[model samples]
Target chain A: MKITAPISTPAEVEPLVRAGARELYCGVVPPDWIQRFNTSGVNRRVFGNLNGYADLERVVEKAHALDADVFLVLNAQQYGEQHLDALTEIGARFRSIGGNAAIVADISLIASLAANVPDLAIHVSSVATCRNVESARFFAGLGASRIILPRDVTVAEISAITTELPELEIEAFVLNDGCVFEEGTCHTVHLPMNKGGPICIDNYQFEYQSAGGGQPHERALRRLEQNDLDYKRWLWYRFGNGFSVAPNGYPWGPCGTCAMPAMHAAGVHSVKIAGREGASERKIKSVELVAQVLRRIEAGESEEKVREFAVGLRGAPGHCASGYMCYYPEVRSRAVVGEVEAKVEVPA
Target chain B: MTIPQSTPTLPAPPGPIELGFALVDERELAAFARHDRLTRDDYLDQLGDARDCVSLPENAEPTHFFLGSEFCEHLLPSVESIDRAVALCERWGLTFGLVTPIACDGLFEPLRAALARLPAGSEVTINDWGVARLVQREFPDLRPVAGRLLGKMLKDPRLPSATWARMYPNGLRAGPFREILDGLGIGRLELDFPPFGAADMYAGIDFPVGVRAPYGYIAKGRICKLGSLSLDTPEKFSPGHKCRRECLGFSEVGARPGTHELHTSQRGNTMYYRHAAGMATAVAEAVANGWVSRIVLSGA
Candidate 1:
């Protein structure tokens, strides 16, 4: 399995590459506004990307010299005129640098890169929601060299995909945070007239409504509902989508998680870490952690030990729930009932 | 407008309509391009192929490019820069809009300032309550759509059920839709419709594709529930400061990719629509079937 790590500053680039990360993905630039619809929820100020493309070019060059590939996330949905020209300029820079590839979702951006910078490879972003074999094929057919699978799929589902699309390279997340809502279901947001209704806050509004109006809704509903909240809980339990529940509620520190092995065992071509949002220290440490785990896996450690080491890196008490994968009731039942150490010491 | 003597549940519309996909800024476009690493050809192809535009017949669709916004805080950026960019689109005959004030602070201050400078009947989507409200209140001739879904959900979770039954003051709930209905603007709702392709892909994933899900290297699903959330939190229960855990963006059943079986081929699936085509189809169906006469398409 290929191990990928996130790097943000110039300082951590070396450690991540030394840590056995196959490719290094970083972002020095803010997400361009063209594709705001897809990622309007994330606060841009948090990542310090306000500097724009010049900063990104600097970061990419430094990362490349370390012999690591940089996948710049220019991934935002495009909507206006200035956005197109910005892309053209950015595309030219990407082509000049010989960077690994550009990851994106909007077809127009993809189309733009194809026209402006043919040398750069296009990788379909997970944000594009390529869960089915067809979506993967569509992107691959459109020249996407790699497709990232959604976080909630089980190994079984991934295996099913491999069976149909054998040659396609699959990238999965090993250690990083992921969302549980269905990516790309935003028609309701599209409605021009505000349908005088209510908005659910804690990710389970659909369940609240279908469960007989809240308490009764949870008790009376015989079958599951598809609201954002229910689907969130379902994914958490079924696919192990809940990786590192920060003891303090914030997703920070090494105790959070490192997921490369699970992704490797599941047969993903590349095991990537969620980047850009991470701090330089956390990013460096994350790379080291994954490298250590990869060495152990390559040394032929048992799958149990590998998983244990990965979870142990969390430095907190927790177990893998496979929430993002398929939710087989029996598997979930076994996992819920299984004994897990929750805290294992990372190898010195 | 008078209501019909009898109100019946309306059937979903049929057929897909063309979208004049537009957005708010250059940074957004650059970000999207970097995220996807789309090629110039890919950009042009979408513009050339985009036949169905969500535009007034005279208003052309932005050429197959991902449309972006010209909005800025407290200031209307010079149209010369925008004109230069739009000139590219006009050369290609692509229809894109220079949207302002969709999701911004001090909404109308910038919009009125910007609108005053644009041509009459220029195509633009506005989301500011003040602008929408003022458009209706002052400039009834100008059509501006409400950008946010304000009153549709409860702002305060602590409010009693009884309080919800009795509608709040018209302006109080106006945070989401007041700009549209108050005739301050176009009195139209602009849906930030999440694209369809990824939803189908997301629906095929087994886990919850929400922000609260665990972090890992694999990208399995999209965050569909963020901006389109419905008020479905438990009674007076607070999940604390974890924005990831709390803060449901909207109240709706977000798509579940976990249960849906993903077909390798786009042709064979009946249970789901073509990932990209579905959005267009939904809009066309809505219009052709008269579920709605028009809709403003804002990507996010």
Candidate 2:
């Protein structure tokens, strides 16, 4: 499977490509858009965009020269009519600069781009929430050449879609970044990180009460406590445990390295490393990790060995054992359930 | 006395605004039929009588019944349940509609089965684009309504009204977006009353709009942390795992206290907050202007 890495600058393009990214994706926010809409750009991210079309042109040129493709991100959930003309203009310019495709989320935007700029390939963003084969077929009908499966979709579901629609390219999230809620269905605004981050990760004091008023029974209280603990742990995992990197320099967050064999066998065309706004080093390390796993899968290594190597490289067997960091948790249930060695080993 | 004349009142719309009831399952449908109104016992308990339990206006009888969920595919009604809902709607002379969640591949067969049971003109409120495609291809006769989940807007309850107004001054008035919906055969778009107000949010939209009231969803996921409470750590956050439906019994209330004074409730895998006091007045104005064609009362 090809590795699709996130890039924020022309400088990032060469490093990510050298680190084994066959395809690169980035977002550009023009000064006018930021001045008008403020934080609400064409993408979910509020910051970390290329300076302007000049930067975009530079990034595209650099990627193309290095034998890699660049895709522009216009993947916000929805856009008003005021944004239509500017967005169309951006797409036309990106295509004119030899950009490979545009990653879009809004169906209206997709339809508009497909009709207005026919030559530019469209890859449906995961924010579109294309979970089922019918949804895939729906987007494909609208001129989408690729679909990025949401992080919540299971490996089995991913395989089902890829197997059914062999003609359409299917991409799955394989490394870095996770969301507490389904990114596509979540409607809360993500203010800048400094101004009180995403609402999903905000700390809140929770209290459990009976539906009919008054205190809950003892048994129910116990369960509620467990639920509370589980919820917090899940949140922490989703937030990448304070966004810390592993001792081996691998990024810590939701991962799907072990599922690569199954995803590849299922005909998934590419694997995406999320976190377009991440630091350059983090992005490089993330791409390097995925490239290493892809190399193993390409060499026809055993699934068990590839998983073991991936986990060891992550240097967190305990987190892996909990299955909290897995993008496809079923891989653990199927392959690592009875294997104690995989759970106990921690790379020094 | 003549100097204090009140503002002139505009003429009322031609007819009573269409009222609809959105239920999660067969039990809620039966309760609504028995009580003749929708009530959130949990929501009331949380507020401790500060607010009323009934979500609807006084003595308002609903003309439509919508069954199913907009966020969780696991909560999709069974074939038997759909049949009973349809029968109930027919018996009550109410329009029948089906609300579908963001479905996975495994849900397609069941979703199709449910869609097949609906009558020719039943409204199918879809949160998933895939379901829209399904209706367009196989069930062309069934009308598709763009459910509130698909209506992406900034809905941070913690933010003040002024912030929301500034953030989204004119909500969802995009021509191209509406045209796409029109092309997809969607007749009406479902919305939540924005934190600021509904007047500006509902402006300039040509299609009919349905506003779901009292509780607006903030965030939702497929993993269902509430449902997985009983499982061990290894299996806790797995998506699409079977569960005992713990969310049906009660909900968890959260408060930010001294921070932003944000209060939220967790029902199933989704978090929601009650709409502001101005929503009712805003809905009245929207309905009067003929922009909002329906008001669907939900217990979530």
Candidate 3:
């Protein structure tokens, strides 16, 4: 079982690289980051205004230097033709950088990328809503090399898929937060405005637009009636069936712990930790600790001894405990998703 | 009585051309009764008109006289229901088929299981992949009609733009319905349209006016009534309501009193007549032109 983690900063990434981290994944940079960081002002005309490529390139180069893999998340679900075109450009750059990063869930882009660039390995994003082995086989036939298994399946379902499709690599999300509504089943991403429900981050651009529209207090009420609002109305949500929102917030990312380790044990090509937006430090530590414990497991250490080692790595003071991945579930909680309480110490 | 020598031909190709009508409920069937639109007599009557044929359901038994030698689709709720349907069709000497929402699980399986009981030459239609996969695996004779909603295949972006010609010659393009139907391969392949909603935008006809049938009525967020269009029920079929039910998969909240609207945005507040008109035209054309052979009425 190969274990991988997400590391944002040079500080966090260096240790994990040496620790033999197998892979790393991260999100696109915020639009304002180029200006905010006193860099050349960013504009969409040159690079379509998406400036996150440099950061991704840097991470890929560094990780590659350490002989580790880097996965770029072009995982935004809602996009149009233009957005897909931009992705095609970005994907080309990703391939050019000697980056082996496979995109996460984002079907439209997958369709586009598959058509535009067939050589790029297609990792069926978790959100594509593949549920059964039949569906997984369909994706595999369609040239998907691996599938980020949905978070809601029983271990049996996972096992069955793995057994049924030996040629296909199965990746699972381990560290879970609250809620198991599963990725493909939840339409929270496509949920209509309920006037009463919390603002739907179902669409990140919509969330970004709403967030940037004004102050938080004002945006809250306006967002409830998002359909009525304009200006940022350019963004629209697609609510097709077979779409689900996981217990995690609107956009479901990976579980950082249990899933990655299990992926390793299951001989999943790579086990990935989910967080990338922030918590670079926690991301590094979590990956390192998880990898350490997995090494011991691979070494035939007693499950109990491995459990003790995990406790120290993932228990309180674990980087993930605070507000990095999910707000709920303490770092040391016994909940399956809270931390690998048995084998790995979850960092506070 | 002078027995007609030939069915009234719609003026076309030599072979018996297939003809079908959409139905959502029993009221629509009974409404056809009111107009003397179709009956057992019409069964023989239509024989001279067309050779190939299939008739959609009308909240009624498959043995109904209007459906003759051609296939009949019944919306069976369960495998048991499918068994009953198969038995009835055999007794009546009619071709049998099943129409079910993909969302319904139990309905498809039993129908597939009951396929063995069906006489040597019976047929089945499935809208969901599970049933289609199962039926195809179990019974090679199973004829699957890709449900309109389920057949909306995502354009495989990996395929070269040039390869689409080979992949989906009649694929529905990504624009309005005309493009969608044509670009998505749906137009090329035979499929059923959702009953009583929008139809192919390119169709240039309208449903026969003054046809009355029981319609599901929602008022003030609740189903206050259910009856025909002419019944003057308390609730009316708001275009907005219809749009929500058909496109958005939910009921629209707080639509303006006695008003209906459609817009590009699923939940947009701004009302656009163009969008509404487009949907209306598509619905009318599908019915008038036979692009849609069946209509599965809901809320009836």
lDDT of 1 by residue, A71-159 (tens): 76655422222254565466667668666787775544565666677778887776554555544655675567788765544455566
Task: Calculate DockQ per candidate and list them.
Answer: 0.05, 0.54, 0.04
Q: Write the per-residue lDDT of candidate 3 for residues B1-300, one digit (tens) a residue.
A: 345443222222222223232332222233344332333334433222221122222222223221110011222333454455455445545455544433222233445555665554444433333444555566665444443323222221112233321221122332222322222222222332212234453233121111101111110111101101221111121111111211111111222223232111111211011112333344334444555333222221
Query: Residues A49-110, candidate 2, lDDT per residue (tens digit)?
Result: 88888999999989999999999999887776677777888899899999999999887788
Model 1 / residue B285 / CA error / Å: 17
Computed on alpha carbons, the lDDT of every model, listed in order, comes to 0.41, 0.78, 0.38
Candidate rank order under DockQ: 2, 1, 3
Off by over 4 Å in 2: A35-40, A192-195, A333-348, B1-12, B33-60, B160-171, B259-263
Q: Encode model 1's per-residue lDDT on B106-191: one tens digit a residue.
A: 23454555455443444455433334444445444444543322212112222233333122111222122232244233544433
- In model 2, the clashing pairs are A135-B130
DockQ, model 1, C-alpha based? 0.05
* TM-score to native of every candidate shown: 0.47, 0.91, 0.49
Candidate 1, B174: how far from true, in Å?
Answer: 32
User: TM-score of the candidate numbered 1?
Assistant: 0.47
The docking category that best describes candidate 2 is medium
Pick the winner on lDDT between candidates 2 and 3. Answer: 2
Q: Higher-TM-score candidate among 1 and 3?
A: 3
